[model samples]
Target: MTDLIAELDPTQWYRDGRGPRYKQLHRHIRGLVSSGDLAAEDQLPSEREIADRAQISRVTVRKAIAELVADGLIEQRHGAGSFVRASSNRFEQSLSSLVSFTENLQARGITSASRVLLKGLFRPTPTEAMVLGLSPHHQVARINRLRSGDGVPMALEYSSLPEDVLPRPDKIDLSLYELLRARGTAPTRAIQRVIAVNATAPVADLLDLAEGAAVLQIERTAYLASGRPIEFTSGIYRSDIYDFVSELRLD
Candidate 1:
């Protein structure tokens, strides 16, 4: 704490013409975390200690700490002071490609795994039936999974496939696309809609995030080469760790 206090001297961090004082403090502390000067899980000095060393008011210090917490750079524990959070791995997924979550992680050299929360053949819901072009009387294979990369929970996925496309839900262990391809039912294209949403209680629990955390909701309907809709899937992903990118081109 002493070393940290000395390093945060006002002369070095607090400066004129650098926007707000609180923001300056916030950037300095963020730099420390990024540079590994303040490693993950390292305890931060008390607000009073930092304020005293930086020659700033406690209010200023508190505001800076609040910004850090909101940025996911630090976390405050009740009665335990602030701590640098462990850096999370950020993954960029290309919107131009049609790929599975498992494939995306594997391409990045991350070990992908899933915890199957639910899987069975069931009557298709209205949305599922409409999206997959299934009749109300037809059944669908529903698979729900908590997806992880290198053991970090990253997404909660729910997928419904026409029974003809996925006859055996129990046979699915890893990639659903792999099974579909083996059965000659792989989707050649998809229409996806992405939206920002706050995590609900169940989604937060599955993704190991606090309730109301920002998340990306993706709803997709995938089609076979013959233009038949085969899969309808919805997923909630951690916004802090995922970036969806697209390359735009002019005609």
Candidate 2:
């Protein structure tokens, strides 16, 4: 770990325009964790040791460590210093990209699979009708799937599409996006909202989490290039195992 810390070039920190020293340090350490150089439960160097070695004040180290702890990447134990939080099950996902669960896991070299919980044409729920721009008489293909990575259940997803768009759920095999593309009704963009909720018994069981455990509830509507709503989806993800990230630019 010391060698890993020493490997960070101080000059690289300055290249970001000498911002808050603590912020720089925070980014540095977080980068190490994100890059897999620091595994979960690995102890961080002592504040004084890090300060002395990096030629920074202990105050800076403390501030940076505090931010890390707040971000759930680090945990502090009274009398035991700090340690990296377990992230083997955790995945950091980008909000800016319109990607499927399969694509997301594939990028990280993890096998992705799904178990179909429910599928077929069905009457639209009130909310689904409103979101999918469906008429009262229109039916929808509702697909409920339990998505997994490396054979470990990760999320429960419920998706509804106008029957006109996806007339048959039997056509889908691995990825919904792939099937949509094959049908030439693929979504080019999406709008999503995320909230924290306690897992219900069924959802918890599907994700292998305890009942009432914190989970991330995501609601998404995907659109075609012509701005037509094609799919509306809701998913519950294990909070202990996932991180959603959105990057911003000042300019």
Candidate 3:
């Protein structure tokens, strides 16, 4: 802890243009945690120690530490000062790419697996028929899966495809895109909408999150090269561990 205090050089705590003193300190500590300079479970110096080392008011130190705790980057224990929070398996996915969950995880060297919850060929529901351009008599192949990365439950997915596009739903043990590509019907593009939702009891159980925890609900329609819709998928993702990033540029 003494060494940790020494590393928080007082001179580095304030910058000419950086907003406030508290925010500056917050960013500094967050950087240290992100860079692994401060490992999980490592104790942070007491507020007085930090104040003395940085030559700042204890109020400033307290405000900075409070913000860190709110960010889920640290925790305060009763009678035990504060500590860096244990790292969770957080993942960032790019919105610019059209990729399957399996492919996304594989690119990061994370093992991906899916547990099939439901799979069958059935008459299309009204919404499914409208979305897939299927007639009432047409059948849709449906698959529901619990997707995991390195054995940690990540997302719950339910996908509906034209029956002809996915005749053997049982054959999909991993990447749906891989199977579609092999059949020469892989989606070339997609329209996706993401929204925040509270976890239901069933969703909470599957993702191992508390009931009412915030999660991301994604609805996607994937199209083949010829502009035909091939798949309609709805997924529930644990927001605590998943981040979707999109780059913006001024035209």
Candidate 4:
């Protein structure tokens, strides 16, 4: 681990430059882990050791380690220091594009499948009613699916659509977006918000994670070309098996 840290290019550590030193270290260490230099379950050097070698303060090392822990890249033990996390079913997703789970997995050459947990018309929650623009008297199709990639459970999706837009729940299966396209109500754009949440017991069981594990929660409202909202969904993805990435460019 010490040798691997030393192997990182010195030019990349701009401790006195624009960004914070800990961020620089975080990026460098993350690269090492992603590149296989630091294999899964490998113990990282102590904070003091890293600080002494890198000529930085222990504070910086601690901050960088905290960020990596939150990202699910490293797990810190009470007395054993930090170890690289092992995830055989990890996936990275781009936030720049609006695509269904099936489409995303297809692009990665992974098989996507869904186990329908619930599918039927149901009364909308207050939040769902507002997001889907449905009347209080109307019902919506509430569909819960356990999404899998390469036969491993990856996420639990709960989606709602105004009954007037979808009507028939029996015909919907696999890809909801595909079915929407056939109905001429496919979403061309969407507004989404993502946040980190602790997994509940039931959600943990469905996603094969331990209770209280970290999960990424995404709330999305999808709209058609006419600007009419077509779908509202809440998805809980296992952080250990998924990553959301976005690229930015300066003009």
Q: Relative to the true structure, how large is the alpha-carbon lDDT of every model?
A: 0.84, 0.82, 0.85, 0.80
**lDDT tens digits by residue: candidate 4, 1-251:** 44655643345444344357777677567656655667899988888888877778999889989988866789999988899988544788887678899999998898999999989898889998898888889999988899998777789899999998878876777989888888888888888899999877578657755445578999989998899888999999877667899789998
Clashing pairs in 3: none
Candidate 1, lDDT over the whole model: 0.84
Model 4, which residues run further than 4 Å from truth? 1-89, 249-251
lDDT of 3: 0.85
Per-residue CA lDDT of model 3 for 30-118, tens digit only, reads: 65665567888999999998998888899999999997897678999999989999974478988778888999999999899999999
Worst ten-residue run, lDDT, model 4? 9-18
Clashing residue pairs in candidate 4 (N, C-alpha, C atoms within 3 angstroms): none
Judge candidate 3 at residue 215 and give its lDDT. Answer: 83
RMSD versus native structure for model 3: 12.6
TM-score of each: 0.69, 0.66, 0.68, 0.66
Model 2: per-residue Cα lDDT over 36-148, one tens digit each: 67888899989988787767889988998998897678999999999998854469999888889999999999999999999999989899999999988899999999999
- Model 1 TM: 0.69
- Candidate 4 steric clashes: 0
Once model 2 is optimally superposed onto the true structure by TM-score, how far is the C-alpha of residue 1 displaced, in angstroms?
24
